[model samples]
Target chain A: MKIHGSISKTASFRTTNAVFIGRSIRLSLRNAEALIMAIMLPVMLMLLFTYVFGGSIDPSGNYVNYVVPGIILLCAGFGSSSTGVDVAHDMTNGIIDRFRTMPIQSLSVVTGHVVASLARNLLATAVVIGVALLVGFRPSANALEWLAAIGVISLFILTITWLFAAIGLVAGSPSAASGYGFILLFLPYLSSAFVPTSSMPSWLQGVAEHQPITPVIETIRGLLTGTPIHDSAWWAVGWCALILLLAILWSIVSFNRKAGRR
Target chain B: MRGNVIEVKGLRKKFGHQIVLDGIDLAVPTGTVYALLGPNGAGKTTLINIMSTLVAPDEGSVKIAGYDIVTDKNMVKRSISLTGQFAAVDEMLTGEENLRMICRLSGLTVAESNVRTVELLQHFDLTAAARKSVKTYSGGMRRRLDIAISLVISRPVLFLDEPTTGLDTISRRALWKIIDQLKERGITVFLTTQYLEEADQLADIITVIDEGRVVATGTAKELKSRVGGEVIELFNDKDDLIRTVSTTGSIHDIRQKLNELASIVSPELRVNIRKPSMDDVFLALTAKEMERSLS
Candidate 1:
């Protein structure tokens, strides 16, 4: 079939992004099980930790203020991991093959998943924050601090989402992607998100204090409570930027490798 | 050759140590159905993938719509569409959404995309189920939707790799009708199938491949001729009356042979003669290749 006319060489960046993002969001919304896990798991954890162990864990009489940041980190971590599962599903289901053959931007597929995951995690974070407020959590931050907190969280979400999306592309199955999520979910627990790193055992404190999640949670915690904005915020930004850079490169290389193979 | 939409030369592909496509060559003219007939594991899909730019060939050159598949891939992609053996439609999206998404991705404006989506839904008889998610669609409906998605921006060439592999007879015939319409619209079709009957019914030209090699390439009739002419069967209860004769003669000659056999053997013997079909051609050609390879 010889088409007489040539296709426009101009790539439609907007249209391609819209198509992929719309598809990703629509598909994620339909997966009720994944949505419930991404949203409700953090809410349940918030309720359990605040009501059950709030007083014992934080005798400072302001447990909600401390635990809310931790729960928000938890929500972001768990929600980003779902991006991997979605990417894995797309890879194994042959949609990736279809996408590869199209004239659209090559990275739009991964970008779509990353953007949708950011939206989902932000929404989940909002819900967690709402629940925390309802449970008597209060922050001393001003409007700028709140905006900075959101900016920091969004960056963190973007970084982790890309990282896991890469992992999902490399994973053998959706179930395996979920298994990879457990590693992310466990990070906040080991970090200072849930408690002061000083409270951890002397042998374990070093790890708990230095991991990526620790600096991020501490930054969010400091932002929310009007604490001294110190090196933790810069460290968090650096980690996010580094992870995003690596993840983007890894994802592009892996995606090309996968698409290049028969 | 100037009007050919697909030109493949010495096309070769290897998976690890196994050569899946062994230096094959082909040319598909514009607005014709070129059927690739092969048994399972004959590397039909590998060939399609290389042409469609989904996989890279280890050796050889493929030019689709006058664009080299390796160096000018985007041009080749913009000029062709592929429907794989599996339905590649997104199951979570509605049938309409799927079509519109593909249209939008192809750079169609929203209004144009919507109009095209509706037109395709109606054309494929999917309008009734357009609002339902593809996960709810039957195999036939999904296959139609998958094809519909590929046609969102009708390119010059379409590659259908076993498009009706698992479809029922009715669905298969329906897909064939759609493909025929595509050819009528001046779209070049490159189809791969294991069904000899399908190739015979729809192909303007047929290429028979086996074990990663092209065994024969010609029209269905031309291929059938390669396997010899009509078959004559003589049957009877008496063992001596039975004869297996292969001849390329007229019905009159067949009747005369049966009459001569009847006089010599048993008058009760029955004779049946029929044209050699694509099935016979496929079997004969592939079997020949297998024998030659073994020897």
Candidate 2:
């Protein structure tokens, strides 16, 4: 019968991930509406914050620089939110059953969505960054700092995409997963995405300062525009690493619980 | 291809307070089409889900292609291809892309994957729609693609959980022809269906379950014989059945039924004798089981 492959262990892992990642990427490209929204919404937000709110927030004309990192994270958030819906659809739909019956690690299914989310957000972030430049946002960072900024942004996307995947696994339906996605999308607003933590109401300052989004955004902002890094990078990487670990664990547990596979 | 390809013992599953499969047992011989027939809510899907390693049975031992479904789940999975009740095909991808996806997952090389995808799409009669998104497919086309995806690799066993549910008669017959081919390839197919004709036409052995319990298991003829003998029928001028007297196919019983029919006979009336079909077998056995449980 020459059944399913006798591929070596490492080769099988590579093939499983490549196949699923390729599947997710193809579907993402096919979804023109979501792809447009992922890029357009963030660019529009950057414009709004830079022109409409930028004047009132920062009269000195460099408000674009202040808001670019935040907009970048928001773009990533939007991209990852779609991943949640995707993961939920796969989990709740009958297609996952087909995958579960195959001789491969099912974790690849969730990771594919996460990786695709990373790739998508990177493109969206690039679009947002380009718009930021056109709107007069200036950065003093050299190549090394630019690389660090991209590193932080990527880790953040991976973290949140896996988080959404966990939510998708736990949600009963795609709509429900998106409902939770909407709630998580507001994370950027509560952080230092658009405003300074010091300028916010004193009582609200603690949350704006302590949340995962704040540290990652501050780290990206610091790397890009020469703001004080001052251990924010450590917190940024630490928080992302911790949440990524937890999200992976949560997704694996829930998927195993649901599919009854290891 | 002689011994059992699938073996289940003491299979039990419960969801909350409802029992789905209760102490069920069955064996499917290699290279045969084994049909599970039951009414709605008979736990057929749950049983298939367990065998395909999509869900763990609360209590049972299931072995597929010599691998334990629980402990050696991967081996069991490698041996089975499942087309669930739903089409389960990716609507976003074209029919050819979906086939290629499964081929890649099955670990085929790039050249082999392309050739296999083209072969499967053409064989499934999906070549014309191969480049179109699956969302554009009709119900029958989607079902055909679903089964084609399952056939991307040669597994020893295939599980189809209500594969033809909601399909039109023509679509169902088309799927039946595909199942017949799978049988010819010596793949042990386990499918669940509520349609008695599907069971009768396709199954080498038909097992009927009712309310989480197996009420009967045998060849179609064996189960029909269990319903026992023929029926003497009386029809009116409108072809309406007037009365039916069941017989054990004995000469004395035939004479007795004929005598009974003579009393109600008239010039405008007609008489006929009919053999019990799988439908009769199903109705009689399910009803008898229900009655037994109620008592």
Candidate 3:
């Protein structure tokens, strides 16, 4: 049959991506128990750190207020890695080869991974946010500021998710993809997540002070507390932009590599 | 409609130092099944992978449905679907959802996708198991679902890489029937198989590839013809047989000598002139290669 030609190229691409992303979301939702298990890890971490260790950390406020933003970032990092795992599983099962021969937009592959990652991270982020409120981690900011904070965090989730998806595409096995998540978990701890930078040793503090993640955390923390703009906010925005750009470039290159396009 | 739909010339691929495909050429016509038969490590899969645009050839040009696979990759990809030997269904999805996913990937709208999914499920006889998760499906069921998923897109050209490799007899026959139906619909099928019987049953054209090169190409009849027609299998005791043949003065030599003398002679020890089969053809081709190597 002669398929419709009236659909514009952009529309076709967008539609294809939406369909694939929608499929991934459906599959994930169907396995909601496993998904909830994924979310519970970060939620448990938030509870443990905020309530048990709340008094020991001197963050000039309740420990939940100090650690909740970091936990939210942790949720994003942990949850986004599932994209890689799922892609790896697809590769192992030969589903990727099936897609390779079809006429679908190549961008749909990336979009599917990113969208699914965002959806999953959003759920985990929601759970963390909910638990934070229950534990007295209310943000003093207005609604718009809270939205901005969530926006930046989601963007961070998206950028990192795409990067990990690419990694999973080239990974030799599913185990490799899941195991790689541990590498990303170490980044946030080195940032201003748990304690103030001054509390760390000088050399370690220097390393932590200049890392890209510290600014992201600080920016979210600032927005939550309704603090004014600081030099760190500019640095945070720069880091996020750089990460987003690099992730996109890397993903495109890796996709072409996987398909042997070049 | 029977003209060549896929044409490859001088295709070559190398992985580091090992060559996979070496200067291969092929032509597969529309509305027919073309079987590329080869043993393992013979570059059959690599050639299919290249033709399907899954891998780039180091040197060569390929055209599918008149579109260049490299420059017009998207267009070429649009006209084809591949179902690999392994099942490609998503384990988390039901059998029906897997086919629907492929329909969506092929740019079908939601309503269209559902229609196509139902059509494919019914065609593959998976309607009863449509709602069962693929993770719970049997091996044969999953294989059928995989083929069904590829067809959900309903492209004009399909590549089946050993579609029946591990299937049971009944499932294999079912798949063959489905493939026959596809050919009746004028879809060009490019398949690779180790099963000589499968090739004989399905291929309108057969290309025998070995050691990264095309050893022969023809209809089953033409390839079988290469093995010659007459045979004399004497079953006397070894020495007695030799003595009898010697006393009989070598019928083949006698026939050849008589032909040179412009006379016809018929050999008499109950000679058989049976048509050669595909196995005979394969042996002849490989035997010729062995002789060439030895010389």
**Candidate 2 docking: what grade?**
medium
lDDT of each structure?
Answer: 0.85, 0.88, 0.78
TM per model?
A: 0.93, 0.95, 0.88
Predicted candidate 2 versus true structure: per-residue lDDT over B239-263, tens digit per residue: 9988777789787988887886677
Misplaced by over 4 Å in model 3 are: A1-11, A59-61, A227-229, A260-262, B230-275, B290-295
Instruction: Assess the local accuracy of residue A239 in candidate 1 as a C-alpha lDDT between 0 and 100.
Output: 91
lDDT of 3 by residue, B38-74 (tens): 8888898888889889898899999998889999988
Candidate ordering by DockQ (highest first): 2, 1, 3
- What is candidate 1's lDDT per residue for B1-295, written digit by digit as tens? 2488899999889888998999899989888999999999999999998899988888899998899999999998888888887888888889999888887787777787788888888888999999998899999999999888887777888889898888999999999998998988888889999999999999999999998999999998898887666766777765443665555777677667777777787667777777788877887788789899899
Model 1 lDDT per residue over A1-262, tens place? 2222235532488878877888888877888788788899999999888888887998776888888888998899898998998888888775566778888786788789898999999999999999888989889989999999999999999999998999988888889988976777788899988788899899889998888998898899999986565799989999999999999999888888887342
The per-residue C-alpha lDDT of model 1 at residue B47 equals 91
Please list the residue runs of candidate 1 whose C-alpha ends up more than 4 Å from where it truly belongs after superposition.
Answer: A1-6, A9-11, A260-262, B234-245, B250-270
Chain B TM-score (model 3 vs. true structure): 0.85
lDDT of 2 at A72: 94
Give the runs in model 2 whose Cα sits over 4 Å from its true position: A1-11, A260-262, B242-245, B257-269
Residue pairs of candidate 1 with colliding backbone atoms: A1-B187, A1-B188
Output the lDDT of residue B136, model 3.
94
**Per-residue lDDT value at B57 in model 2:** 87
In angstroms, give how far residue A251 of model 2 lies from its true place. 0.6
lDDT of 3 at B133: 87
